[model samples]
Target: MLRIVLLFLALGWNPVAGAAEMGDDGLHKEDWFSITFRDVAEDIVAAKGEGKRLVIIFEQRGCIYCREMHEKLLADPEVRDFIKANFKVVQYNMFGDEEVTDLDGEMLTEKTAARKWGYVFTPTIVFLPEEAPQHVSVRDAAVATMPGAFGKWTFLNMFRWVHEKGYQKDEHFQTYHARVIQEMRAAGRLDAE
Candidate 1:
């Protein structure tokens, strides 16, 4: 029992505790993530119905960046809770054999979809608007895409930015993040980086 606990601690499993469960597909499982039929259009409708933005995350098995994201950013309760409350996240395995229905009505396997979408990274996160354009693929319709892992503040801020529809504003993500960082520092919620 002690050895098991030690091993788990070494693997960064304790902070997330119950949240660290892994699927057979080797992706970390979050109970709040929407499990659907992999239909992009239907997913948009479902997310709208729930008053949440749509997020599609592409991850591959044995991806260290994916593991880091799951173990660190997603594990932090502030980040986890905010994202769960605001986003309807649908996870896709970048190299998997699962069939996905794109918004343009094209049916392709996960790997093919990744190639079609031009996602070359393991942890590419695609954020869709509240209403996607008709007859467009998710890649084309996405308001923003984060291609790699980031620290907790950046990750959480990205989610917040999308939820706030920051893409539609004059301020870019870098500006928004910088402004928020200053605010957080002023409020003493975050220390200097």
Candidate 2:
């Protein structure tokens, strides 16, 4: 299948610069934290059982942002540490052969699942419970969706925003964004400020 070929191609790729391998803590280190996905459903189920959040990073073969997340953002030591401690990460080829049970109770191809969830772009990360309601289906977002690439500081702020359940209070990213910026200033990323 096309996806099979693409997966092989991705695995074969070398960044040329040979970025450091990220560890379980989401830190760029000398170990491999990247997992080759086998069974998504089972892994998510276990991850939830263990009280780990599920961060499903959906990406395509040719997406540069996806590569950056893999090579830069995710490869960063801080991010890697946070991810390892807080989440069970999974990667899927947007058009791969993986069959995911979407927000709705329908089983769909990874490609169709992405479309059904209405993510029309590459590198959408979905945060959700392990099992969604039967009626939710593949066509709807089963959980929270973050689209596009955000730099390190912004993404970390976003993580804190979610961690504090800020969205449930205001449902406004800008509100949380400002609050996080203030908090960051208090912590004295003065140079960043």
Residue 70 lDDT (model 2): 68
Judge candidate 1 at residue 79 and give its lDDT.
Answer: 86
In candidate 1, list every pair of residues with a backbone clash: none
Cα lDDT tens digits for candidate 2, 1-193: 9788778778895443446544333333323333534344555576767667666777766677776776777667786777677677676667776667654446677777777667777677766555544555433523456788877776665665555556567467667777767877899863331
Give, for candidate 1, the lowest lDDT window spanning 10 residues: 12-21
Name the lDDT of candidate 1.
0.88
**How many backbone clashes does every candidate have?**
0, 12
Query: Given candidate 2, what's the lDDT at residue 172?
Result: 74
lDDT scores in order? 0.88, 0.62
Which candidate tops lDDT? 1
Residue 193 CA displacement from its true place in model 1, Å: 6.2
- Tell me the TM-score of each prediction against the true structure: 0.90, 0.71
**lDDT tens digits, residue span 40-115, model 1:** 8889889999989889999988899999888777877888899988899999999988889998999999999999
